[model samples]
Target: MRLYTKDEIQHAVRLNTTVIDGIESAFTSLKTKKVAMPPIMRIDIPANNGEVDIKSAYIEGYDSFAVKLSSGFFNNPKLGLPSANGMMILISTTTGEPQAILADNGLLTDIRTAAAGAVATKHLSREDSRTVGIIGTGSQAKYQLEALTHVRPIDQVQVYGRSREKAEQYKSFIEKSLNMRVDIKNTPSEAVNNSDIIITTTPATEPVLKAEWLNEGQHITAMGSDAEHKQELDTNVLEKADLVVCDVKEQSLILGELRSCSNSKLINQVHELGEITSGLKPGRTGYNQITVCDLTGTGVQDTQIARYAYQQLNFKEDDYNE
Candidate 1:
């Protein structure tokens, strides 16, 4: 089988609208019973401040599928290593043989996660949205804005971060790469106040966004709480949403923002992203609707992205030392 390094995968998988389109198709396949994706398997190692997640999915009628193992060691930065790293194993469904191994080190996850945001915003947000706000100043924060600009006509970016230096760094990066004016906000409320689309990308264990901060016609994509103990949006904010969507209903109800939103009486139904993508359910019914998409990440996204990268790269299966 071939092996693709992170650098090679990064070069092949350009973070652009094409990637977003592939992700959008994955979501549709998911809701239409064209995908078989299991619940995420997570192993938390509190002693090491780390967690490992295993995800896999098969698209019906496809010749291949992918299984990805990703880990996040929060303390790795002290050792001069990245906190997140992992690899993907692509397998041929027809013969049950390994096709390729992508040592993406979580780059695929980060890219697909952000592209998922753009897909959600494109279908759910008002067409006139030109401003974007994001919480956190990490790599996901940059990817989120980059994907947004590809799907929307974003002209301004407002960012919030705990560190002044990191916030400035994020601002400079956006201004240079996207050629858009980016404002560093002193508070999360300030960042969300005027933006048409707001994204919270932090791993905050408690609420960082409040219900009162959300305005009509605005869309919020909360992607922080991928574990049971993590959260980013207040429960009340989710309850008051005009429409609420989850990447996977089962995963979301168990560990995503939907866990806290389960008891809300205002929301009679919970929509899955795949369902919306497949046209089984409607998205963005009105210009004044308050839409929220809770993404916990899914295996179908991993498989789709893996397949895309494999198709773009030149295979080299010469690692056989036997």
Candidate 2:
């Protein structure tokens, strides 16, 4: 198998805004029946201090399977090790042959999650959206900002985090990298109230953005809540949404925003991002509508992105053994 290092994967895989575009195109194709993807299977392992997960998924027509193993970085501060690490494997479906292997671990995952947010914004956010708010100030936050800039002409950004230093750091980073003005806010509510579009990327177990803080016509993308117990928005906020969409209905219902509101019968309707891409569903019926897209991450995305990365790098199975 061809083995690709983290640097190799980073260089070979075009990420951020452009990759988000590609991921959108891929989902659109899937919606158009151009590609087929199987259900994603994920295994979560909770340790004494941290957690690890292994996920595998298959893409139809392409005849290949992609698997990813990832771990959290909670204990990394003391160990001097990066919090997250993992790898992806591409296997041929025709002969069950191992193809190319990428040591992406979490880089590709972050990019795909950001790309999902971009896809949702393109279809759900108002066309005149100018102000954006982001909750969280980690690596994923960077890609989320980059992807948002590609879809909309953002004029101002409000960032919120528990750590003021990190929030200020991210604000400066975005201002320099995207050349747009960014402001650090003291509270999550302030960030939500000040922006037209809100993106949450933290790993919060409770609601951070409340229903009362949101206004009509604002679009929210909640990306932090990927586990069953993790949540970022008030369950009532989902009841107030004009529309709710997810990367996959099944996955989101179990682990995303839907989990909190599922029992209350508050969700009016839930649709997949692919359906919106296929034009089978309407997006943003009016400028005053509140829209939310909950992304819990998926292996189908990882499979497509991994294949794309391998193809870009011209990776072949024989290279690793040579």
Candidate 3:
């Protein structure tokens, strides 16, 4: 049928538009009014000094199926290859036919994740938010910053990372690109101490930001914890949060920040991000409220994005038949 490279998808889909649309569609599906998104299945394959993960998901209402195959590409340093590589496949739901292929798994994933953050920010962050803090300095960190900037003024940014070099590099990149001053902080505490909005995108096994480091009137988006042993915030931080919303409650409880605090029943009253998106539940009650949105990542997002890619391709039976 039709094919779309990562560049084409980037040109065709705008971050804010795609994100807002995906959130609305996904939440509508989750409410059981329309849409059908099955759980995502992932397979990890060990490679030469690294591993690759293949993920597959399906959305019913959109009449499409998608499979994302990507790798960590950690061996790039020793093998002279990129650190990450992958692609996605979109299949027509009407006739179970192949529709389109996209070769930028990383880019697609980043946009969807950022969009999820935007949705959370729109619902949870205070209307007066201006300053933002980012606790990682990688590719995903850039998208996170860009997505937040699209939603808020973000006059000031505080960046923290394990590597001072990378942190400064990220700061320079964003400042030059966004034309906004980015303050490079030496420590995670420094980044979160006085920020109005915070985003954590690290792969730390232990807590990096302590509960005491946070202030009132702040919103936190924890986007790095996607596996069982990954965590970026102190369990006590979650306990102190005024409200904790997750992309999916079941997935978060198993692999997100909720896993770290499982020993205690402190996160019992958690709500899903979809519920907040649907307006079924209230977001931030006041400017002083402490809100946390734990995004463990979900297949529903992949499904919705895949559908968007298919529409962009303008797939038709004639193209396939030819």
Candidate 4:
């Protein structure tokens, strides 16, 4: 088996149209091909403000599958370490042998997660979406914006973060890298009021974005809630949406914004994003409709992205000492 480091994986995989298409295809396969993806296994370490999630899946036509382990330690920055890091192990489907070890250090997860956000925005948001509201200043805040540019005609950005320094840093990076107009807002409501599309990338256990802050023709993508206690959107936000979508309905109900949603009828009406991608369900039926997509991350994304990364790199047996 081949072993690849984070640098090698980062060199091969990037958040671009091709990578976005690969993730979009994974959602399509999830709906049409009925890929077997198990429930996410989670381990929480409250003492260190950390959590580890294990995800895996088997796609029908793929030669290999991926079992990914990703961790998030919110206090890592204080220790001079990244908040998120992990790796992926690819196992052969036919012979049950290991194919490769992608020591991506969570780069693949970050890319695929943002790519999934892009896919959701492409299908669920308005065709004329140009202005975006960002509700966090973390790495995902940057990656999600980069991914959105591929699908929407995004030109303006409004940001709201708990830290002024980090928010300013985010604004500076965005203006320099994306060449877009970015303004830092004092509150989340201020950011939400001015955008056609809003993305929440925080890991707060309490609600960050309120339902009253949402408006007609606005699409919201809440991607920070991957654990049972984590939340980003107020429960009422889901109730007010004209349509609510998720990467996987089952996972969403357990680990996403839907977990806070207590309305039984609304839960039944929720649609999986894959169904919309596969053309089984309609998306954004009306120009004035309010839409929301809750992404909890998925293993199908890991499998497809891992495969894509492997295919893009050149492997040599001499590179690693056995």
lDDT of candidates 1 onward, in order: 0.89, 0.81, 0.79, 0.92
**Candidate 3 error regions (>4 Å):** 34-38, 47-49, 313-322
Name the candidate that leads on lDDT: 4
Q: What TM-score, to 2 decimals, does candidate 2 have? A: 0.91
Candidate 4: tens digits of C-alpha lDDT, residues 1-322? 9899998888777799999999999999998885889888889999999989899999998999999999989899999998888999999999989888999998898899999999999988999999999999988999999999999999999999999999999999999999999999999999999599999999889999999988899999999998788999988999889999999988888889999888999999998988999899998998889999999999999999998888776543334533
Name the runs in model 2 displaced over 4 angstroms.
16-18, 29-47, 263-265, 315-322
Q: Which ten residues in a row have the lowest lDDT in candidate 3?
A: 33-42
Q: Residue 290 of candidate 2: its Cα lDDT?
A: 93
Give the per-residue lDDT of model 1 (tens digit) for 1-322: 9788998788777888888999999999987756788778889999999999999999998889999999999999999999998999999999999999999999999899999999899889999899998999999899998999888889999999999899999999988988999999999999999899999999899999998998999999998888888889999888778998888878888788987765745445878888888899999999999999999999999999988888777532222232
- TM-score of every model? 0.95, 0.91, 0.90, 0.95
lDDT of 3 at 82: 70
Better of 3 and 4 by TM-score: 4
RMSD of every prediction:
3.1, 3.2, 3.2, 2.6
Candidate 1 lDDT at 240 equals 76
- In model 3, state the lDDT of residue 134: 88
Ranked by lDDT from best down, the candidates are 4, 1, 2, 3
Name the better of 1 and 2 by lDDT. Answer: 1
